[model samples]
Structure formats: C-alpha cells, structure tokens
Target: MFKNLNQKNNDSIRVEKDSIGKKEIAADSYYGINTIRAQENFNISRQNIHPELVKAISMIKKAAALSNFELGLLDEIKKNAILEACDEMIDSNLAEKLELDAFQGGAGTSTNMMVNEVIANRALEIMGMQKGDYDIIHPNDDVNKGQSTNDVYPTALRIAVLKLLGPLTKSIAKLQEVLQVKEEEFSSIIKLGRTQLQDAVPITLGQEFSAYAEAVNRDRWRLYKITDRLKKINLGGTAIGTGLNTSHSYIFKIAKHLRNFTSLSLSHSENMIDITQNMDIFVEVSGLLKAASVNLNKIASDLRLLASGPTGGIGEIKLPAVQAGSSIMPGKVNPVICEMINQLSIEIICSDQAITMAARDGQLELNAFSPIIAQKLLNMLEMMKKAIDKFNNKCVKDIEVNSDKCKQILDNSLAIITSLVPYIGYEQASDLAKEAVNQDKKLIDFIKEKDIISNSKLDKILKLENMTSPGNNLSE
Candidate 1:
C-alpha cells in the first residue's frame, strides 16, 4: 500500500493521503518501520552519529555480539544475525525496505533497535519468512536477550572510543616528532620570551620548541592513563548493578568473550558500585581530553601570533598558508589551519564541560546521561584527532623561523638584564632594564646614560648567545 502510494501520481497521492487521513511523512524524518517510534514520535535534534563514529560503533557491536555468542550468552543463530546486521550497518548494505533512523534518545536505543530490527528481519528472510516476523527472531527476547540499554550502550561506546584512540595516539606521536624537529632546527635562534604579556628575557628558539614537545608528550601520557580507565568494562553489571535474570556464568563469560574479540585485554571492573554509580572515569577521560585541547590551543595560538604579520605584528615565525585571508588585502595569507585547530580545541573544551555536567547530574546507581557523555566525549576525541592532523601536516611541518626577526626582537628587549648581572651587579642591571622600558629608550642607550658599563664591556657581555644562554651559575 505504501509503495503503491509512493509510486502514484499527484491525483493518486492526494487520494491515498486523504484515504489514509493526513499520513504523509518525510523519509528523512522517518526511516520506515525499523526506526524507533519515539524518534519519529519525538523528532528532537536532527543530530546523528557521524559516519566514522557509526562505523566505529558498528565494529564494537559486532565484536561484542561475537563475544557473547562464543560465551553461550547468545545462541549461535542470534549472534550470527547480530554480527551480520552490524556489518550491514557498517557497510551501508541494509535493504532499502527497512529504513532506520541513526538518531534516537535513550543513549542509542534507536540504534540498538535498528540493529535488532535488521538482524531479526534478515534472520526471518533466511528462514523463508517475511520481515517484522518477531516470532522467528524476536527483537527484544531473542536478539537482545542478555543485554540492557545501560550495558550495551556504554560497552559499545568504550569499544568505539578505543578504536579512535589508535589514530589519536598516532596524531600525538607525530606532533611530538614535529616539535622535536623544530627544536633542532631553531636551536641557535634567539627570540624574546614573554611572561604575563611582558617581555622577560632572551631564550633560544629551541627551548620554546622543546616546551611544545614536552606538552605533547604529557598529553600522550594522559591519554594512556585515561585509556586504562576506559578498559574496565561494566558490561556484566547489567541493570542496577546486579546481574539479575542473567545466567550464573553469563556475565563473566560474555566479558571474556568481548576481550578476545577486541584483543583489548578488557576486564570486568571489580568495583561494580563505582562502575554503575560514579562516572568518574568519564570525567577523568573528559579532563584528559580537555587538557589535550588546552595544550593544542596554546600551541596553535602561539603559532598564529608569532606568524601574525610580515610588516605589522611580530613576524617572529612563519606558518604555511593553507588559505586566503582577506578579500581586499593583497598577499593576505593566513594561518587558517592553526586558527581552525584553535576553534576546534575550544569546542572540545566545551564538550568536556558537558561531560563533566553529565557526570555530576547522574543520581545513585545509574547515570541517566551516560549516552550524552559518551557521545560528546567521543566527538571531542574525533575532532581533536582531526585538528591535530591538520595542524601538524598543514601548519607545523613546514613552519619557518625568521632568524633575523628573532635577533632583532632579542636585541631590543630589556629582558637582557640578566646578562649584565655578572659585570654590573644585579641592582644596577635591574634598574637599567626598568629605565629602558619606562623611558622607551634602548637598553644600550639606558646603559650609556647611566654609565652602567663602557661600550667595549657592554659589547662583550651582550652578545646574543651570551645574553640568552643560561651558562654555569657563576653567581652561585
């Protein structure tokens, strides 16, 4: 009836619509019968899992189903159907008749149903039965027998997130290498260092690059730490902590099965109380992601500021131009890639906040917002990974330091006061710096006016390397 109406002309379309009584529905809005009625019923945010995330989720689900089947938690028939359905979703091979919404509330209840419907329908067809024949392979009883929304959703999320972690780890490692290379490349170049937005003293460019590398290293370690937390699965703690209504060996068996399927060495967390009630692990992961975003944002901001202008701003370093800047400003290349990374980092930070709130919002025994937390945090990871790749490849890899500009800035900076300490004494050097900065006079001019040192002595002490390098503590 529906197919006939869809193929009919306007006259037939109107007649069918009138006959059905206001039954016209958009396909995009409703993905056929397989879609959750509430999703069509609620129609909230149009947001759906991204394609990469969907693929990742499908992979996780298949692995989990395979594990359960092996453990005897699910029968072979149901397990095979679930695995096939996961592949269909992952490969976008589902038949056109059973349309499904990728978006639904209840932390992927819609997605779970999509999988259930697809598997159940496919299994029915295999048995030479029609679609929606729940008697053949029931969606809830047979297919989702040993699972709950809580366990399935979080487990799938962890598995999906872990998959992305591989790429994320590679990203940080690549960035670390780039920063180390920059350190070597800019080793001898002296540049003015800033503290609290004021010039402090001269420092070799290598030191600055080394700091970025260290930050990346720290983030990578933080990622590893959070991954340990994510590895502890709560799959067996179905419903409200206890494995009620499940077989005696089902929980342990399924978890072990999942472990083998993923090869992630996953363990059932010993503390079911912590696992079921507290989302500290979620918050901890969010914090690590937040730290990563902040670290990357700092690096990106510095790159953009350092590469600000050839004539106006501090053109201390140059970032590769990935895009045009201003429409009217000729030769107006911009650090668009770095800017994008900054923007994406900010969003990740915001998402981290959302995860934090969700963690705090959960009541005893079950976090109602686990779904949102999982979605937002996973999105943060994905965005952060992509942003890092862009910044590393398009911006950091080809960056060039303006040796002349660095030298000029270092020469003019009053922060060179420390260099004069050994010869003129600390009191005199400090006073000289203050005078130079306050009077807008050069340090050499201030020194000359104050008779702090003769020109020959000043020249000997103020060589750029001598000024910046922290030599043996002669004062000490």
Candidate 2:
C-alpha cells in the first residue's frame, strides 16, 4: 500500500548519477539520487520508515544546522534554508517518500542518506534552486556536515523511542488507575482464592485486582528507569566515535543544541568508543519490555479464566460483551479484549527476542542490524500502547463480578476449615473437613451439630476480613 503512494509519472523523470551509476529520479521528489538508489535496493518490507523516526531525524538536522551556524561552519543563508527544510520534513505527512525497508543493511546509512537527501532538496527549493542542485546545498557537505550515519541513526532512534515513551507511560498509568479503581470497587465482595486451580482460602475480589494494579505500577517504574539509560546517547561520536573530521567544538555544541531543541535530558556519551561498539543499553531496554509483556500476559490469562463461562467454567467475573463471540453460536460473547491483549503480549515477547539477537549480533564499531532493531522495538511499543488503551476502555472498566457465584463457591469450599484450625487444633480440623466433604454437609453445620463452638464464635472466626488477613486470633 505504501510503496505505490509516492510514485511520479514516468515522463517527469530526471537523470541523477551517484558514485556507482546513474538512475532516473522523479523530478518532483524532495529526496535526491542516494535516496532513489536505496529505495530501489531495499524494496523488502514494503513499509515506510516510522514517522516518529523521520521527525526525530529532521529535528536532529535542524539542531545541527543551528549549531553549525553558531560555530561559523555554515553560512547564514544555508543555515536558514536547512532549518526551513527540516521544519518542512518534520511537519509534512508524506511518509510514503521514505521508501527504504526497515531491515536495510549498512547500519542505517541508507536511512540517514534518505533523510539528508530529502532535506537538501527541500532546502534547495527554499533557496529558489532545483532539487538536484547540490552546488547550492549539497546533501553530504552541507546538510550532513560534521555527522556520520553511525552517530545520527542511533541518536535519532533514541529520540524517537523517547517520544514514544510518553504515550506508552500514559497508557500504562491509565490502566493501573483503572485496575486500582476496580480493586476499590470489589473490596467487600468475598470470593474463594485458588492455588493450582484448586480452592485455597478466602479473599475479597478486590485483592485480586489490587495485585494487577501493583504489577502495572511495577511496569511503569521499569519504563521510567530505563529512560535514563536512553538519555546517554552517542550523537557526536561521528564515524567510529573518534570524532574524526569533526571539530571538538561542534561535537559538544551539537548535543547542547539538540537538548534545547528536543526538550529532553540528552547528553553526549562520555566514552564515544564504548557507545559506538556496545548496544547493551538497547538490550536492557528490550529486557524491561519483555518483563512488562510477561505481566500483561499473566493478567490477561487470569481474566480469561475468571470469566470463562457463565454456566460451565469458573464464572467468578463477567467480561464486557463488546461483540458477538461466534458466527453460528447464538448469544455468545467472547473475551475478545483479553484475547487481543494476550496476542499482543506474545508478539512483544517475540519482538524482544529479535531485539536481543540484534543487539548481541553487533560486530565491532557498529551494529548493522540497528534498523531492524529500531523497527521491531518501536512497533512493539506502539502496538502495546494501543492494546492497553483498548483493553482498559472496552473491557476492564465494564467488568462485573458474580457476587452470588462467588459466595456460593466460597460456602462450598473445604478450605474454610483453615480458619477453624487455631481453635479446634489442626488434627481435629482436618477430620472435620473430611467428614463435612464426605457427608455433603456444610462444615459450619457439621461443627454446629457436634456442638464444637458457639454460633457467635463461629461467625467471628469465619469473617471474610479475618480469613483474608493475619493477626486475627480465633480466641478474640
């Protein structure tokens, strides 16, 4: 779908030559010769580069232009042109022109060139020159001055990931808040807790929701902590991090300008060589994402089980009926939201594995697999954010508890004998539990028939609050 969007008429082609050979580029294209070459070479994913990355790259160029102008490296007219062009790229919604695959080779050199060429041609138009007029504003010497794909690609990736984090964190916080609300709403509704799918003890439905809320809170914290790691970028570590062909002043000044432009707490790496060689930070971030996926999968699975059936399964809760569950089965409503979240969690886990392998596969001075890594990571984050939003709005907020079902299950469970242990002794309690189960009688009724304890004392001992908490003495 994206590949066919930005194509120009064949008659409007103009011949443009590069180091290797010549190609016919669309005359109206803001991207020049190198971008066309990459577009032809990597027709793989058929998907355009992410818009967030494009915006981040343009912001980087804008910041670099301002910094270069400040350092006397770029003339006023060229700097203004580059800045205006960067703004155009940033504001434009034409993502289809960015035709390179996300799985490209060369450590994102193709990606960087695409950005540089687009900016250069746009800057040329701003200066009243044709798109291919490199003499007016060269993509290499002017637009990409004092930078290499090595530094720019990773730096833009970091910025883009940071931009994405805002929505992700907001979604997670909202989910946590909704879960907390459910926790409070279900606070007094008693239910039978389970272990290994067997009755264990008594607990309020609110306690279960509270656990989900706590898990989401932990995920939110993990995301917040990892942002600090992403902040330490290698922006000025041009080429192999030696800052070769780039002045020291430009290296420091560019990062400062970027921080001002992005409003992020970004800083240049202290050891450019290490930052250039190691991708451990990305691996760590992926690991945290995997952790969050695990939590979501677990929560979704629990919701599915709890809302399994209204007649056959453990129907302790009822999920919201958003749509029909089946095409043939009448009056069927499935836990589609939970299933969607579960599937998204699995995909995120797989993407994390891909990111891990990519991070580890980096050879020496650069990770050539960074394009794939960036795409998978960003895709997972975006999908998870949307999944969370849908899950919250369509499912979690509308969930209803089966209070009668909960009480019925709790009343029949032999696990209630646990509360009688302190008063009757463990051995006696065990015997009574077996007798109650065998005779198909309520444990409280059997104990009452045997005159084991007064009705009031039994009532106090079997209180839902007492059973769910510790330090509740049976003697009291």
Which number leads on TM-score? 2
- Tens-digit lDDT track for model 1 on 326-371? 9998889988898898888889888888889888988877777776
lDDT by residue (307-399, candidate 2, tens digit) is 988799889999999999899999998999999988988898898899989989999788888888888888877888999999999999889
- Model 1 clashing residue pairs (backbone): none
Best by lDDT: 2
The TM-score, computed over Cα atoms with residue i paired to residue i, of candidate 2 is 0.95
Off by over 4 Å in 2: 1-7
lDDT of 2 at 28: 70
Give candidate 1 misplaced runs (Cα > 4 Å): 1-34, 50-79, 90-108, 430-442, 445-460, 472-476
| Backbone N/Cα/C clashes per model | 0, 0
